[model samples]
Target chain A: MATEHAHVEEHTHPGPRQYVIIGAILAVITLIEFGVFYLEMDAALMTWIILVLSSSKFLLVVGYFMHLKFDDVRFSGLFFAPFVIMVSIGVVLMALFFNLTR
Target chain B: MQYLSGIDDHRTSTGLDNRKMLMWAFLGSDVMFFGTLIGTHLIYRNRSLSGPQEEILSIPITTISTFVLLMSSLAMVLALAAIQRGNMGSFRFWTAIVCVFGSIFIGFQMFEFAEFAHLGLTPRTNLFGSTFLVMTGFHGTHVAVGILWLWTILFASYKGKIHQGNSLQVEIAGLYWHFVDIVWIVIFGVVYLIGAYGAEGRALEEVHHAARAAGIG
Candidate 1:
């Protein structure tokens, strides 16, 4: 990417071709996730596989298509910090609710 | 440069870009809303006394909707591509199509939820129903809001206000659209697939009981 950045074109950027590439990769990951589900794998393994594949697609869309990776780490931290906190609160809520009747 | 770039590059929005900023703020709040709903749905998943629940979630059907949404994201990118290429015709066409597909997904969701309600469960029914509806409903509202925004942008395109200068605004909106797609992917896996996992557990239990009855492997 740094190498590509060095040869930047001036006067009206042609837009990144990476969008098409990312779309293809996302499709492949989706296919793999579906295949894993119908296979003879255990539930735990299947869950992990789906989670990993989904996260990969998520990051690719965010980092590349959103231009978050190139723009600023501050932007990444700004969005992701809140995202993590929200998920944590969710986990705590789930635990509390589950333990209520236990 | 050898390329004759049709799109303008020096153009930008004023004052931190209101459209982009608004989208970010809304998504931040939406993440919390959905997180809470999904958490509860998962927590009380086993609390259903007579569950006509996620076990009823059909992947092939949901998968088709998911596929539609994924394709919408693709069209969103293509719209951005069209704008960059200075093809307003293509851009408008694609954006309109994206809106159409988004609306279709939401329509299917309405049907699915209606079916869920017809099964004698709803948001006011119980813990399970409340969480299930809220979690999926929150996502549904986002899709509705997106379609509304697409209509506004489509009009803006006709008025010439949404030119290449403010393409960043559209890009930010696309990011939100894609994030919704990603969330649906997780929901399909966790809420639907793992929900199906519960059914798989029941099937396994039935097989075990049958084996014991037959005294066979």
Candidate 2:
């Protein structure tokens, strides 16, 4: 048990400074999202841009804040498998339901 | 033994804390659950042929709420860090702030829901109302549960039940709180932002093509 814990602690977690930096980045991305929301561009283009930006926020939170980036790889495998599967399912559902076209 | 670290001292076959592993697995399954709900909302988004559609959504207010939730995640991590460092004072302060922030986000949702209701939109109003209310309503419920969970942890710390020696408690709560925040990230972008775009008569040509393909246009 001691050895296991030592291994877990071997990965250096982010300090408060890193967390504050991450929070600021998240806020900035959100502000950009707000700005992008009003941009007079193609709806599809804005959607993709927002999706990319939001995905970045999601990854940052999961990686740094949640400590997944520094934690055991097994945890990442467990979370990402279902996450990928569900995202794929969402896309397929959208395609089928919307009959998506160019 | 480094008991002060947040990692549990328990031995597991997977060499990871069982409780944390269980939480991750549960979160993975939750991803599918919410995926279905969000997908439902998107599928039915443009199908509402009634008044009080997505255009009635107040993006500015929702944006403020999103920012609050995001900050709460920050506070949650800070709380976890404090507990790990045996800084009980800082832990309690950050934890309390997290609860407050979570409550504010819920308050925003309640206001938004009431405003939508006043505008003649309810679950029974149209497909949009049903899917939108159900999706975001569930997300709001999760946030409420997270608030309650953090409050319980705060109260427990007062009882000496939580400390650096057992900071795993705070870590678990932080995990749940962060999950809730991430879910909102997806909701804010996909549902509110994109849905609003579609509702403003600026929907993608594919939307019209889809509508025509289905003979709804």
Candidate 3:
């Protein structure tokens, strides 16, 4: 158990400074998302841009702020497995809705 | 055999700490829960039969609220770091800040809800109102619960029950808090930014026509 735990701790967890930097990046992404709302562009292109920006922000919060990047791989698997399935289901449902609406 | 670190001292047979594992499991389930709610909101978008949908959603206000919640996540991580370092003062300070920011986020939500009600938009008004309120309202409930959880941890730290050797308690709470922040990031993007943009655009067009009618522009 001790050796197992030591192996886990070999991964470096971020300090407060790194956490603050991640937070700043998240804030900037959010600002850009809000600004993009007012920009005149192709609606589809705008949607894709917002989705990309928001996903990047999401990854940053999960990776750094949640410390998933530094934690045990098992932990990441536990979280991301369900998340990926959920997102896949969401996409399927939205596609169905689009089909019906069209 | 000795424990690897003080935080990992309570590890289970899987070599992972029990509380942290449980928190992750719970968060995984929560991801599915919010996923359904968000999908519902998106499906019902623009399906309102009556009542205001877009004009009532103020992007600026929500943007500010989103920033507040993001900072709270930062505060939460800082608190976890401080406790791990055994700095009681810094831990308590950052924990208190997290609670404060969490409460401010809730306060903003409450204000928005009340203003929406004032403008005659209620859950019973239309499909959009029902799904939107239910989804965002539940998310607000999660934030409120997180605020209370942080306050409890803050009080525990005050009693000296939470220390460097047992920082996992705060670490788990921080995990939950960050999850809530991430959910709001998605909501802000899907619901507020894109969901309301079309309605707001139409509203702007109406204003333009009114101005032209009055010979003001």
What TM-score would every model get versus the actual structure?
A: 0.80, 0.90, 0.90
Question: What DockQ, between 0 and 1, does each candidate earn?
Answer: 0.33, 0.65, 0.66
Q: How many clashes does each candidate structure show, in the order listed?
A: 0, 0, 0
lDDT of 1 at B107: 84
lDDT of 2 by residue, B148-210 (tens): 999988999999888877777688779989999999999999998887975657444556877
Instruction: Give stretches of model 2 more than 4 Å off.
Output: A1-11, A100-102, B1-9, B202-217
The lowest-lDDT stretch of 10 consecutive residues in candidate 3 chain B is B1-10
Please write out the lDDT profile of model 3 over residues A69-96, one tens digit for every residue: 8888989998999999999999999999
Candidate 1 similarity to native, TM-score: 0.80
Ranking by lDDT: 2, 3, 1
Per-residue lDDT of model 3, residues B11-85, tens digit only = 689967888999999999999999999999888777665577776799999999999999999999998888777
The TM-score of candidate 2's chain A against the true chain A comes to 0.86
